[model samples]
Target: MTTNSKYNFKWEDLGDIRLGRPNLGTNTHVAVYRLMQYTMRDVLEKQLGPDKTNLFFIDAGFKAGVEFCKNILDCTLGFDDFGANLADKLLEFGIGVLRFEKADLEKMSFLLTVGEDLDCSGLPYSGVAFCDYDEGFIAGIMHQYTNLNFEVKEIDCWGTGDRTCRFAVELAKS
Candidate 1:
């Protein structure tokens, strides 16, 4: 399948989309989290339908997180650059240059919920949010993306790996 059709995403006139940084913590992987959010937009929008809902499965624990992040980083930035600290890269990139940290749970989990909501059968262009924590990041991105805000909650999962946690920013969409 074509990338556009496979991911269920479509180009919008919103210009460039960026995610706000989350409060830092040892477990907070902000860059990776943000990357997932934006990428999900593309995935669902392209693979499903412009107005279709989405579902996102997230890694529940730490060990799985490491592997998830590694795989995602390698896929997006390559194995060598994957070793590069994402926080440092974000700080270096400065404002307007968003990064997704692999450990940022609130952001990451929030995205998963929203993605699932989007994947669900519901109102077109409208969606729900579910997460392992509060929906702070979901609201943050909604405000950041469409000037809207939303609520979120956590969803339990049978902790698994084999998923990538790579961070991405909308460079440009064709």
Candidate 2:
């Protein structure tokens, strides 16, 4: 119900991976990441219920996205260039293959897709969209770039029997 007051996350919390893991390096198996994610989801769902668990993931992801944008992205670029940079960074980080399906710069609305998404690309069909965190992540990135709140919804996901994750992003109504 309340946030912890003693600690706030900073990008520095990631630490020096090269210095720390000189032998292992930066890369790890995707399954290992999913193991932590799914297990945490399971415990959180049991304790907080599915809705709240999703919210927690989204909120955490939003924080991460904001930090990521601030640290990794070049915010000075134009919209098109920003998108291209973001796509490149996502791929470089092994996050996903980001593609813009549609864009309406005047309306601040867009449709985007991430293929081979880190979260749920190979997941079995579960009849539910499993990318609430991704939704918040995109919104956070957009917010950081444009200084505007966005409403991001995952419309298709591997959990929903879709091959790629699709999202609709629009400026949030004030």
Candidate 3:
């Protein structure tokens, strides 16, 4: 896919939320967020089909994750500290509760879980994992942190009858 020369996203594009919504602030109902997400998915699926639509969401989420890491996270810390900071930031932003279930620093692989995920925490079982965006999001964050490509896959999700979203992250085989 070719990059859009006309418009490229940057962290500054988010603008000053505090100035924009003085009273309401940055918080919004989860239902409102889910409405936008689900509606966008529906429209994209209709136009592009499921696989391509999933790719688009993953790509968009990757971009968002890269920018979020650059703008919101401290990248200079050690791995454990960085993970802690990431978890804290996720919670602070009301995104989710992040935890590392397993980590192999030698292999650069991890099993991470997100509880109350912004994407699919309470979703009913649909016999499929529905956190493609989150998969890319984690990969993007790891890319920024380690300066290496990663393959991130969601093996379990609320959509798959799991209470939390679980991802398997590993270095991308080049």
Q: Give each model a TM-score.
A: 0.19, 0.96, 0.96
Cα lDDT, all candidates: 0.32, 0.94, 0.92
Question: Whole-model lDDT for model 1 versus the true structure?
Answer: 0.32
lDDT of 3 by residue, 1-174 (tens): 236777888777778999999999999999998899899999999999999999998898888888889998999999999999999999999989999999999999999999999999989889988888898888899999999999999999999999989999999999
The all-Cα superposition gives candidate 2 an RMSD in Å to the true structure of 2.5
Write the residue-wise lDDT of candidate 1 on 79-164 in tens digits.
23543443333234331122333333244222231111211212222223323221232233323332223333333221222122
The ten-residue window of minimal lDDT in model 2 covers: 1-10
After superposition on all CA atoms, what RMSD does each candidate show versus the true structure?
16.7, 2.5, 2.6
Model 1, residue 23: distance off in Å is 19
Superposition TM-score, candidate 3 onto the true structure: 0.96
| Cα shift from native, residue 66, model 3 (Å) | 0.6
TM-score for candidate 2 = 0.96
> How many clashes does each candidate structure show, in the order listed?
32, 0, 0
Error of 3 at 11 (Å): 0.7
Question: What does the lDDT read for residue 168 in candidate 2?
Answer: 100
Worst ten in a row by lDDT for model 3: 1-10
Model 3 spans with C-alpha error above 4 angstroms: 1-5
Error of 1 at 127 (Å): 14
